[model samples]
Target chain A: MKTQKYIVIGGSAGSFKIIIRIIKFLPANFKKTIFLTLHRLKHVRSGFVEALSLKANIPIVEPKDKEIILTGRIYLAPANYHLYIEPTKTISLSTEELVNHSRPSIDLTFQSAAHSLKDNVAGIILSGANRDGAEGLKQIKLNGGFAIVQNPEECQVLTMPTAALKKSQTKNIYSEKQIIEFILNCK
Target chain B: MIKLDDIINFNNAVKEVSSYNLSDYSKKSLGRRIEKILSDYKMTIDSLIKKIKLDSNFLEKIIKNITVNTTELFRDPKIWQSVKYRVLRKLKNKDTINIWHAGCSTGQEIYSMLIILHELGIANKANILATDINTDVIEIAKKGEYIYKFNIEYIENFKQAIQVNPYNYEDKIDVSFTKYFEIDRVKNLMTAKPFLKNKVVFKKYDLVKQDNIFAEKFDIIFCRNVLIYFNAKLQKRVVNMFADVLSKKGFLILGIHESIFGAEALKYIKHGEFYIRR
Candidate 1:
């Protein structure tokens, strides 16, 4: 059996457009499971998934706690909750204290993926104003998983990618096009 | 920087030394929480295990810390709104309302329900029982006091769930904070009024244990964010237990971000934010 692949993408601030672009480019049969954790207004819960689903070829889900993880789908960490990837390949949500002033914390999701999936995981940090994903991407690298960052120069807000790059040397610092191509070519 | 092996060893140690069984906790979160404990005590996992074997009091403390006690007043107001209009309204005709706040942390939720019941004129008919594995939180729940400054924002939740009627824009009631709890801003304290505090019976109950010591079926069970900490098997078991303890057509309310899945999902019908026992 082929090893399952998992991709975790963390973004905040100016990363929404980049996420939409990546989703638009992926085909309906994308095999790898994708987890997206973005900073969102906690009170405004209804629109995020609907907006993402409009152009995505694959199913986009805001999973509830302990929901089974499935391939060929995109999971968005719901607002105001931290998302954790379990060794059982299930998603667990927490209303624990916020980390880096955000819930659906990028670091929490990325770290959980790195720990649970190990070498089969890929952690990507995108345009954002904060340093939430820096330590998480570092964990991904330490766990022998792929760690990629959006090229800071190409980002609307460079702080996130720049912080990630400074925390640990990532495998790739790619533009949006390169990022999309890398995902598309994943087995 | 705890490894998976360390977590496993710790879980084994906990189970062997105490009645608590932590093997079914979700690994990632459990690992993270254990890491925090190690850092807090500045001890290695080996030392922690050694301590667990030596002192039962320390073991109790460790278990309390392991269980996440993060809860707030009307943590998700929309669910409480549904409880008011959809759930409690339907139960109004019942001779008595039996409510179980499973895993009730620090008692804000119990008080929240009391306020709602009081507003709905069904306070006298309600019997509320709140439980948690953490004895410290049970004490705090019994006290019904919280940090006023920290929870000042949740006052809005009270307004949203109690004062505003979502279906009718113009239908609104002015409920002062004083009616439910006294806000002593100067002392940084918010204490639940006696009527709300005295109505609830608090107990220390473990969800992982199959025993239902309450010996009574409930009309509503609010487990909320508790199940997110458990692995799938444990979640299924607890959900099944809730199903058994619930009266026919009784409701099992979870956190806004929680849901029932797998074989256990078959036991209840999804009703908006809650599950109805079929």
Candidate 2:
């Protein structure tokens, strides 16, 4: 019943639009667990889970600290916390010092996902204003996981995808629609 | 190229040299922490292996950095609200109340509890034991001060928890932020009021090892955000220890997101976000 082993997605400023678009198309019965980490301002009230759950049929959650990671749902990293995936398949949250000036670091999540899920995972980097997720996607590739980045030209902010291109060992450059296609065919 | 095997071997060496067992920790997060140390010291994996053998302090450096000690004051206000209204409310009539703030890193949670007790008029009748695995954080926790730049979420959480009239609540907590906290605008830091500092007795206690540091059983045990570092087996064992140290009706409060997932979970009944041994 593995739709995909696991999906690790990273984005920053302009990511939700593409993320929502992809979520809109995923089946309610999607089998893989999706972990999303986005850069956000510290102390912003969390409406992220509610907001992402609006059009997405699958269950979306801002996971609690030490919460079990379940399949067939999406887990969003709470603002101002670093999310780490454990080998026991649970998620842990920490208030450890911010990296790259971002607390919900894309690189940290991606890197953790790379090791925990290993080659059975796929790393997707979407639109963002910063270079936070580039090194993370590189980690995914190093661990033999599938690494894909949105085309920089198609991005609202090209810095993130362009940096991923320079930093990560990815050959799959996807556009919004192509990214949707990749997710749909993930099994 | 750094392989997972290399990290595993390093963890094994760490265990052999120092009784610190990291084998159960998630390799990915462990790998990243190791990588961070390597980069910070500008040493390769092999170089780290050599340095680990050559240097005794190297392992402690990794331990200090790797343990997630980062937490803020009044974290997860909803849980605090429950502690006040549900857990503490039950013990309000007691002559004396005792609390164990396990893994009380930097003392934020302990101080927050003291404030609640103060507001409840039980601060004088309370005994608080705050302990952490890291002595460095224990020192800071003893000081009872924190960074001044308050996270807006913290303010919001605090606002929701205080239901009494705002002025009366202020009057109840007469010291206020101004008196208890010496906020330095230029330094952007806040120092704890001496009163709160006096309430807590801090000690260094590791969750991994079994010890009878405190003979008295606690009415409330607040161990939040510390178990995530442990694997399922360790989490189970520690939860049992928490059970051992807690009174029969005493409450075990975990971080809002933390759940007691293993069979040891059967030991307690879930009461909202907390667990109670019935």
Candidate 3:
């Protein structure tokens, strides 16, 4: 059986818009599992999942630990934990020290996916504060996986994505609409 | 007996030193620094001068070796801590935030920021601008990829290296920030994603040469590890440009070792990590 492809999205501050941009482009019938992570306060319940659910026909919900990642389902990391995709496509949670001072670090997700998912991974880093995903994206590209970063000009918060752009090399950088178009068009 | 002629020649040499093309740099400071280098290398002044003059490629190599890239993912942990406590506090209320990565070298720092912001539940609002002088480097930066090497040190200090949060209940996220990476045969070759596509903009810019920036203004300007390349005068000049182009209250972040120092650049402030405001 051909392994399923994983689409991972990570960001902060301006990330909500970034996720919306990509999810909007995905048709309801799309079959890929889309994983989303946005950094926020660990204690506070993020209404983002609900907010995004309104716009996306696909199931948009926070990922539960050990949950088997299903195709066409969108998994969002809960606040304050670095999210990872296991080889079994299960979700792993950690309270370990923060990379870039973030628990649910974008780099953590991207890096883990790059290792576990290999060629089936497509990692995208959006707007954020520091250079978290820069190293993770580098892994994706080295492992022969596709990687993308939002054009900082089009990003709501340019630091995170710009940091990524500064540190690692990427295949392409596109604006929000263009990113959406590319993701949806992907076979 | 003191010779007036010799004293006159010595004075002229001092003036000549000041008049060189590198006058913009503080001679004594840089001279002392280079002298230290010479001493460390156990080379006499004569040999050092000969080494520099005799081989152009060697000179280039020396300069490249000394070039302060001073970079890493989440360079200054305090900066991330500060952003988490201060900037992110405000970010929680906002729907979006835009940031500019100026003088981004291969792209580690920006991705570090994205990881933090994503953890903060604000990744969707991110807008990133990555600019640099080296077109070749910029092209590489756009790839958002890396090769990896696994080291026991990296594994042991993985938590510290990544700055992951240690407090989570219920669905604890277990992304082994270090396990994601494995060592390659090449040294320091990291395998990972640098940034997300559709989240960042990469462009070319020379802070010294450019007078105007046609691109969109930024909410935050990250010129980290870039100012060290220029002399104080050039640093001031670039600082002015950054101030002119930045939005009001926009943040300006520099390298941990770098500072706006004497420049009337931005309203320099000591936040958790060093930051400036226009």
User: Could you tell me every candidate's TM-score relative to the true structure?
Assistant: 0.91, 0.86, 0.43
The candidate with the higher DockQ, 2 or 3, is 2
lDDT of each: 0.89, 0.79, 0.64
The DockQ assigned to candidate 2 is 0.54
lDDT of 1 by residue, A1-187 (tens): 2233999999998999999999998899889999999998755666889999999999999998878899999999998889988778888888877889889789989888888899999889999999999999999889988989999999999999999999968758999998898788876
lDDT of 2 by residue, A1-187 (tens): 2344789999987887888898899998887788889876554545667877888989999887667788888898888778988667878776667888888899889887887788878989988898998998999899888899998888888899989989985888998898888887886
Model 2: docking quality category: medium
Which ten contiguous residues of candidate 3 chain A have the minimum total lDDT?
A89-98
**Order by lDDT, highest first:** 1, 2, 3
Candidate 1: pairs in clash:
none
> Which residue pairs in candidate 2 have backbone atoms (N, alpha carbon, C) closer than 3 angstroms, thus clashing?
A64-B257, A65-B257
Ranking by TM-score: 1, 2, 3
- TM-score of model 3 vs. true structure: 0.43
Q: After superposition, how far is residue B198 of candidate 1 from its true place, in Å?
A: 1.6
Best by lDDT: 1
Per-residue CA lDDT of model 3 for A33-141, tens digit only, reads 8888678754344466788888887898676444578888899876655577767667755433466877678887887788778889888888887788889888877
Q: Specify the CAPRI tier of model 3.
A: incorrect
